[model samples]
Target: MTTELERELKQLIIDTLELEDVTPEDIDPDEPLFVEGLGLDSIDALELGLALQKTYGIQLQADSDDTRRHFANLRTLATLVEERRVK
Candidate 1:
């Protein structure tokens, strides 16, 4: 179940970020997305937040204390949606 969530989240990240060189398998759920692993920047975070808002109907309050915690990685992002998204 969580694997599926991870995959879906990975796909969403790749699609939303326009990562032409990356596949769903390229992402590491526990790795850092901003500094090292996937090399995402601030703009990418904003884009991802918008994509999540559109796709999962979950809004991320920009620059909040929870934003970093929520968008930490694919796992965290998926968990955030699973926890907050309405049916």
Candidate 2:
């Protein structure tokens, strides 16, 4: 991913997760920041999903089964943005 994309993803993560201790520079592209890394729980996922819809206009259907893949990590989120951008 490009630097701009990475930075945007970092900002999204920080904003969505309400991570007061983390900065854009702290997130690793390939690292998992949910269960095993950042310890985010299911509530965080719900909140992040809502925030993502509002911020990026990428609607993630709550009833869909792709929630895991969509919120997998920073890499997946960034790729989703690149793929779904309105342009």
Candidate 3:
């Protein structure tokens, strides 16, 4: 089951990446966001990172393992936003 945060994140990913071929309903929260599931590349990651920061006031370190873990999928990304986003 997808949480509200996950749903929102899915839309954010779509909008941020200009994924005209994708839709929020098409995204599987458990699937990988990069290289396989969504087939997003490193450039997509950078774009998504800026979108997340701008939207949620979340900060990230470039090339960090923790950042990689958070970006692993929709669920983890939502969790990161929930935990660190400014109110």
Candidate 4:
């Protein structure tokens, strides 16, 4: 059901971060997006946040816990986009 959005979010993460070695198929929707799992740093988070905002008209707080939650994984990101994206 949520597979399509998850793939889109995965592609967004890959492109937004310019991760040359990572592909959407390599990402696990349930994996953590940070240090332990995908190993994304804070900078990647910022870039990805911007991409999400530009692509979906989603707003984010740089230091918000809610932002942390929404960035936790591909599924979470897809959920956020689904809930808050403007058209």
Candidate 5:
């Protein structure tokens, strides 16, 4: 069962990245967002981060290890966004 935040994050990722071949339901919450799982690369990460910051009004420290963890997967991303979303 996908949580509301997870569903929202899936859509956000798809829309933000302009992934025409992917849909929200195609994403597994526990799957890694990069490399083998979603096949996202570093550039995708940067783009997604910018979109996340713009959408959630959350400040992300590029050099922080926590930031990497937050971007680990859809579940982690959703948790971070839910905890930090301004509106």
Candidate 6:
């Protein structure tokens, strides 16, 4: 079952990225957020990161390996946000 954080992150991703034809229910928490899955590109990553920071007040270190892991999928992203969220 999907957690509330995962659902919220899925919705945030769809809304922040302006993903047409996609909904939170359509996203798989374990699926990758880029190329092979959602097909998001580098620019989308940047935009998503900015949106996450603004919305959650969490700091993301661009060069950290954890950042890459965090962005791997909805579940990981939600885990990261839950760990770091200040709001």
The local lDDT score (0 to 100) that residue 4 gets in candidate 6 is: 86
lDDT of 1 by residue, 15-72 (tens): 9889999987788898888767999988998899888888889976656678998878
Candidate 6 lDDT, 1-87, residue by residue in tens: 999888888888999889989978889988899887999987898899999999999898757576788899988898889999999
Q: Estimate TM-scores for all models.
A: 0.89, 0.81, 0.93, 0.90, 0.91, 0.93
lDDT (tens digit, per residue) of candidate 4 on 1-87: 448778888888888888899977789888899886899998888889889989999977666798899989888889899999995
Deviation (Å) of 21 in candidate 4: 0.9
Off by over 4 Å in 2: 61-65
- Residue 86, model 6: lDDT of 97
Where is model 6 more than 4 Å wrong at Cα? none
- The TM-score between candidate 3 and the true structure equals 0.93
* Full-model lDDT, candidate 6: 0.88
Specify the poorest-scoring 10-residue window by lDDT in model 6: 60-69
| For model 5, the run of ten residues with the poorest summed lDDT | 58-67
Looking at model 2, report the run of 10 residues with the lowest lDDT sum: 56-65
lDDT preference between candidates 2 and 4, better one: 4
Per-residue lDDT of model 3, residues 1-87, tens digit only: 999888899999999899999989999888999999999998998899989989999987665798889999998999999999995
Scored against the true structure, residue 56 in model 3 reaches a CA lDDT of 97
Whole-model Cα lDDT of every candidate shown, in order: 0.84, 0.76, 0.91, 0.86, 0.88, 0.88
**Number of clashes recorded per candidate:** 0, 0, 0, 0, 0, 0
Question: Where's the lowest-lDDT run of ten residues in candidate 3?
Answer: 59-68
| Whole-model alpha-carbon lDDT for candidate 2 | 0.76
